[model samples]
Target chain A: MSAVLETRGLGHDYGSRKALDDVSLTLAPGEIVALLGPNGGGKSTLFRILSTVMDASRGEATIAGHDVRRAPADVRQALGVTFQAPSLDRKLTVRENLIHQGHLYGLRGPDLAKRVQVMLEAFGLTDRAGDYVETLSGGLARRADVAKSVLHRPRLLLLDEPSTGLDPAARRDLLRLLQRTRDESGTTCFLATHLFEEAEVCDRVAILDRGRLVALGRPADLVREVGGEVVKLTSDDPEGLAVAIRERFAMEAVVADGEVRMEREDGAALLTPLLAAFPDRILSATVARPGLSDVFFRRAGRAFEEGSDA
Target chain B: MRDQTWLPAFSLWQREMVRFVRQRSRVTGSLLTPVLFWLLFGAGYGGSFRPAGAPESSSFEYFLPGTVVLIVLFTAIFANISIIEDRREGFLQGVLVAPVSRLAIVMGKVLGGATLAILQAVLFLAVAVATRSAFSGGGPGPAGALEAAAALVLLSMGITALGFVFAWRVDSVQAFHGVMNLLLMPMWALSGALFPAAGAAPPIRVLMAINPTTYGLAMLRHGLGRDATGGPAPALAAAVTVGFAVLAVTAAVLVASKRRKTA
Candidate 1:
């Protein structure tokens, strides 16, 4: 299958700081790929480069077979972008914003009106068509932004933290709309998000840290590869307990923020041994299946929480 | 997409018009300053200055045409603030990522700004005609009115294009206003709009010579039953205004297209 969007050794720098360092990835048609990263892990830089909003210092990008640098207009035609911040004109109504967007893509007349209506209804925004976007809640404004991005039915959709600031309900609605766009239109979807729950919804996920792609695969596969399950132990001296567990079990233990964590093939089987090994030191213990968070921590040597300093 | 360029242009233009209509306070505020200038300046000097060859009309007669140009100037220059806001809001990025040509984007925005300028000019003209009938004792004829409107439209096109080019590089609203004031105030003051440019310092004359608004005001005066000033041919004034409009618009398109390539 042909890739809808591809980057070859893409690198970008902001002054002395490298925002995206030698990054390369591809999204095949009809696939949903989540870009899991910390705040400054180059997710926004990559999105901006892919959307043709900023130039890369080195390397190449192509969207739907058009070179991003050499033929930006063609690339722009093939891609749609939804930014983290809402971009809708506050003075215009939701329907008017969509219509104006349709014009930008060269759609008009009865056909344009029909497409606007379809998008409005599809995104559950039909009833608020005439309402000014500025008056809409944060969630509704985000919906309008999404509606504008896809008005042209672009082959590739790049969403940069689309669910930020959205309530849980709005986030779910937005995700459903995104899935529908992919399933119904077969458009490749590239999403950048810090939320693990959001990443879990994608078909595949790539974890980026400090401008590097540390891991990439299906979320479940990454979790399994990192180890089967994660066991957490909290104690007065987690560092000492972690060392003791590693020496006794011949397994690696990670000490993070005063918590002892380790991956085990089986949580229940490993917990009994762990408890017996350090009965007096262990204050509390919990075992659960390895998740995306654990996978991220295992690969980056730090929890995702530390990376959201922005 | 290939055949209906005007559809997009018109839609963008209509969007701007609707915005101006919705923000009626902004419209009134923008118009108020220039109208005040007309009242204060026109009344203060109503009896002092007279066109050497003017047909024995009141000083307000000549002031009315200059006031019209001032209104257009204020409207076009201040409309650029919206461009800064649009950039901050990411709306410009949304438009840039679309399939339309970059030229279309610049043209659409310029057209929108020009439309707003024209609306403000109409409002100012209506007020001028209503409150200062002495200025239009003979009443501008249909042909003269058409000529004046044409000159105003061309002036607006040039000003709006210049504003767009400036807006492309300015990221903040404060920076935009600073640059606009620096550029617009000098152009407005030295363009013979507020006072005659003749016999001014050589530097001021030199400044007026390059100013597109100078030609705009000259053409407008000729179209509004005032003396031609025997300075430049009417054809020359029209040509200069059209030439500036073309250059400003072309520069705007080039900047936008370059931004698209590097973005």
Candidate 2:
């Protein structure tokens, strides 16, 4: 019922450059919220603050009723964080990595062993438990990393780009397991990822742009904001066609990457007039309902910047 | 809640042990590097070299403690390099976020490195005993063996923690290696491991006496019934070694887990 995680105007600055600026977020318990943003979009900064590894320069964050800045120990006890990098030692076996993680949380003896067994079984890693982490495939290693993070079964799980570098099968399995875990145990899952598809499965998606929260809502509702259909007209001279269409229909048409695109209540009503107006310049036109990227385009104008190094 | 440092520290140590056991190259490298140094440097410098005021032991026998110390340094440096790599790749962020004390993490890593360093040096001690008996005079007795093992552990702890301090400050692996050479090598060379301070020039003798490692070597030499270069009494030597360990560990924890500006 209460917010599992909440941040108020959280900001971070790297010397003169601001990495996060006046960003606020709230996540409810047992809900899967995805922070979808391009690289350098402050997703990591927010995650770091939530994990209590980095102190916010401005404002505050609380995790599971404890302030992350003033009460890191409490926050840590409530949170399980999985890194983007290879945290498991390449030289140690998968089981050993889990064992170490458990001990870090003060789980020991038979209890620790039992937890490891449960995690290995849950993640389908029993067969590969004895294998060195370096020897395991990338997907298996990532599975081990995830399993190790949740070994102590913290109240909140924070994953950074968990789907990156994972194959489609592994990615699908990870989402399934996470969703099942949340449904079964009522654990809160908040993940930061750039993949729009990954965010689609989450209950809520918070889209960040250049260190600021640009949009926040359900993926479906956000896309629905750009309701009806979008028309993309491919032409050799998209700017000229866009001007022509702007004059003819008095509707705003934007050209991006040499493609003239516009949205309307009914895209078919505008396609005939637009094509007839620029028959020589326009090559083709297609009408389709807006997707998540279309939602982002509506909000940010340009497409989501790719390959951010947040 | 009261701090539960032991569990996390022990876990880190366990991970280090498991890693060392799994990597064959690590096992071989830690074991063989000291032996190679002892054979090549000891033999080459044996026949023609003799320090004034030194005992009747052959040069190879005299080089034993130095080679063992070198192994400890090597193992510590080797183990702490992982810290630099981990920080660069963000592996350490996972560990830092755990509800564990920063000191516990440092202790875990240092203890792990120390255990491996001491273990490898103890294995090499057998060779030292045999070579000393056959070539020089005789091996250290049971008391000497106990003393050598304890000294190796303290030396390992100090060196490993020192490596942690340097590795924490350096961002790249290349810089870490460069720092290890600059920090560890000079200390080893001047610790009366290679040459005794008794017959050295006034400046060199003073440097050896002032070096904390000189006391470690002195303790090692005394434990094995060998005379030291008048560095210090074994009691004082042990105190200084422990002191170095404490200081290095404190510095390391402070630097690596400094109050990061983001939570």
Which number leads on TM-score? 2
lDDT of each: 0.81, 0.82
- The stretch of ten residues in a row with the least summed lDDT in candidate 1 chain A is A301-310
Per-residue CA lDDT of candidate 1, range B1-263, in tens?
A: 24335666677678778888898776766678777877787678778766544556666666677777777777776677777888898787787777677677777778887777777777777766777554456657888777788888888889888888888888898887777779977777877776565556778778888887888888887777666553356788889988988999999988887643232
Q: Residue B183: error of model 2 in Å?
A: 1.3
What docking class should model 1 receive? acceptable
Instruction: Chain B TM-score per candidate, please.
Output: 0.91, 0.91
Which predicted model would earn the best lDDT?
2
Q: Each model's TM-score?
A: 0.91, 0.94
TM-score of 1: 0.91
Please give the distance, in angstroms, between residue B246's alpha carbon in candidate 2 and its true position after superposition. 1.6
- Once fitted onto the true fold, the runs of candidate 1 whose alpha carbons sit more than 4 angstroms away are A233-251, A266-285, A308-310, B1-5, B48-57, B132-134, B228-233, B260-263
Tell me the deviation in Å of residue B12 in model 1: 1.4
RMSD of each: 2.9, 2.3
Tens-digit per-residue lDDT, B75-133, candidate 2: 88878888887777666777889899988888988999888988787778766665453
